[model samples]
Target: MTFEKQVVLVSGAGRGLGAAIARAFIENGAQVVVNYRRSEAQAKALVEELGQRAVAIQADVSDPLEARRLVNDAAEAFGHHVTTVVNNALGDFSFNGDAREKIQTIGWDDFLGQMDVALHGSLNLIQAAAPAMEAAGWGRIINIGTNLFQNPVVPYHDYTAAKAALLSLTRTAAGDLGPSGITVNMVSGGLLRVTDASAATPEAIFELIAQSTPLRRVTTPAEFADAVLFFASPWSRAVTGQNLVVDGGLVRD
Candidate 1:
């Protein structure tokens, strides 16, 4: 389906990669709901910048009630049930390899934190949005993932483990929701050139990754965001339960 006919909701869209995704949807002619947990200032500013097509709403996706409210509010704002949901919200995290907790020292809580936002968060959104999508008979759910599941260059134990579970959810949800005309998929990326979470990564690592990739450059948020759009676009109507990697070929899968 064309984006102009869709109402898209992007979680954690106040800044960083989330913001880029929100901007891409608005540019593609979709009315967007920019979901944010904290970054209120940035979220409001983005809504103002995006004009009439975008609205910013604050909700913690990890909380089922809040997630449900977010979906309802989005439908109310746009006069249509959300046709697409981007599960991009993440718990507090940083990509500094040297600073990451090693498997030996990382606690279960670390994994739980990420899962709460990634896996549980996606579950909440899916449960909340599915009924409406079933009624409309069309929907798109795109979950942001990481190439680390394949390469694990930095071995971010907690983050990688949580995202792996999210990939599993993406696939199973696709199966369960496909009959209702809803497709679920994932877009995974390697170390992004720059984002609030990745800002702590050493420049040397970025350069090394760029040199290793076939593109000889790091992936930008805008570039990754475009892959997400493909799933929501009519071009990928038959695609589901798939993970498209947008890391400049860093992880060939």
Candidate 2:
């Protein structure tokens, strides 16, 4: 579908990869909703920079009610139905390998928290937006995931586990929603070089990842954002229930 005919709601879009995804849609002529949980300033700043095609709305996707409201608000603002969603909001997290809790030290609650936001958040958005997508006869749902689940380079147990669950939801949702013309898919990336979550990563780790990948460099948020656009664009109309890894050939699955 052409972006000009779509309204996109991107969760946690105030910064990092989310921000890049939001901008990608906007540049392609889609009206975008930059949803944020607490980054109001950053979110609003992004909207301002993008002009009227984009607007920032604060809503935590973890709550089903709020997720619905976010979609409603986006529709009202743009005077258009929301035809796309990118579930990119993350529960508080950092990619600092040195500070991550190991298998022994981490508790179930830690894993639960990640699941609550990543898995549950994706469910809430899909449930809330599916009706409109069905009515419009077209829609796209993109879930942001990680390459670590497949490679476990650092074994960020909680984060990787949560994302693994999200990947499952993406495929299952595709089956359930395909009849309505809504395609569900995932775009997984490796340790992004400059996202806020990865800001604490040591320079040596970045160098190591670059050397390990065939591309000879870590993927940038902007580059990954382009892959997300493909899923949402007309180019991928026949695709669904698939996981496209965008980590510079680090993991071949």
Candidate 3:
């Protein structure tokens, strides 16, 4: 459970679950790189709070060049060695009425937008970071996913499909990198109550979810972040290509 002497990178870490993950790593003695797109102020404040162990860098993961550049910047920050990579960034949450048109009216563009961030962005980061992690002979890759893909109670088609692809990618990457001692896994959770991305979900819906879960409460960013840490820690050395869901028993599959 100790991240001492580890260097970790969390994409889209300026706020929400990403930010929580970044803070957790920093608090555990890991040098953290907080990747963000437009939250410069938030990122800077986080860096300041985390002191010298944290760095705030702006990079859009969906863009291949920026994704690679972010890895390069992180390498320079820590002399070409990073042991952990967390793919937690997403393009946008268009669910809950953000769509101007229903699926019958919306083009495939909506789905691709979601796919680009998780699939494309994750592949880019894995490619950029794999070499270094392999050289170190120890690495951790945690892909963020959603439990909605399992339940589909609300039918967020685009988002659920994107997450499914990410889950598959996690397994494939684990298989490919297993020999190199790099473990790739996914942490899927039900709707988190406080993330800005989930803010659009109606309070009534969240209440229903809380009531359905055995825990009687919606998941929190901190709780999900702990799962990320588990996948990153030495304790999970033999576990790879696995999707560990933390949805308060709401999604048992």
Candidate 4:
């Protein structure tokens, strides 16, 4: 319980990878904000399951105004200045009713929307969380990223582009906040099989990734969450602006 009593806000935590990340923080004794956009029932259920340490809030992080509210709500819930922020939210991909939008067919609005959630959404949270971290003289900002951006196996251009932009923002934020004891880093992973959000990925693609990876296993949400916790921990005090890939050596970045 190294993080006992600490406050952590995780966006898009109603299900999938986001939910897993929230659980990890709670297990580590951090008071967690389980943020979601539409899954109210799931969010409330999670909060009850986690007991008093968890608070479920609703916000569409892709919208900058709502993004700010998520942070404020978490700080109020935890009854402390937040010390950790996990920008793990993403937009829903309908993509004009196609299975997936190709680069040529993808519209600029779709691309910007994804970027808004990954890059601008991250920035919004960071801006809201930074003042408190600076006041405390310490903080952690962990950005969730995709291994596909490192090397696209399926070629989801819009999602990949947004994640790449997030990586760029992570480094720059680290540079800006280093003197204040706040560390910003990214946790990039290959296809995660356990997350609900990833369940739509074809099984063949997952098998191919497993074969390609050095460990011959797909990275789990919990495994990816562990890497995120490391970056947020005191042990990584001297570390910042680094993309810690947790995909079992599939793509090193």
**Candidate 3 residue 126 C-alpha distance from true site, Å:** 0.1
Q: State the local distance difference test value for candidate 2.
A: 0.94
Worst 10 residues of 4 by lDDT: 93-102
Better of 3 and 4 by lDDT: 3
lDDT of 3 at 223: 90
lDDT of 2 by residue, 172-243 (tens): 999999999999999999999899999999999999999999999999999999999999999999999999
Best candidate according to lDDT: 1
lDDT of each: 0.96, 0.94, 0.88, 0.85
Model 1, stretches more than 4 Å misplaced?
Answer: none
lDDT of 4 by residue, 57-114 (tens): 9988877789778878877776788889999988875322137777778788888888
TM-score per candidate: 0.99, 0.99, 0.95, 0.94
Each model's total of backbone clashes:
0, 0, 0, 0
Q: Candidate 2: deviation at residue 177, Å? A: 0.4
Instruction: Flag regions of model 2 displaced more than 4 Å.
Output: none
> Per-residue lDDT for 132 in model 4?
92
Task: Please write out the lDDT profile of model 1 over residues 137-241, one tens digit for every residue.
Answer: 999999999999899878599999999999999999999999999999999999997899999999999999999999999999999999999999999999999
lDDT of 1 at 54: 97
The stretch of ten residues in a row with the least summed lDDT in candidate 3 is: 94-103
RMSD of each: 0.6, 0.7, 1.6, 2.1
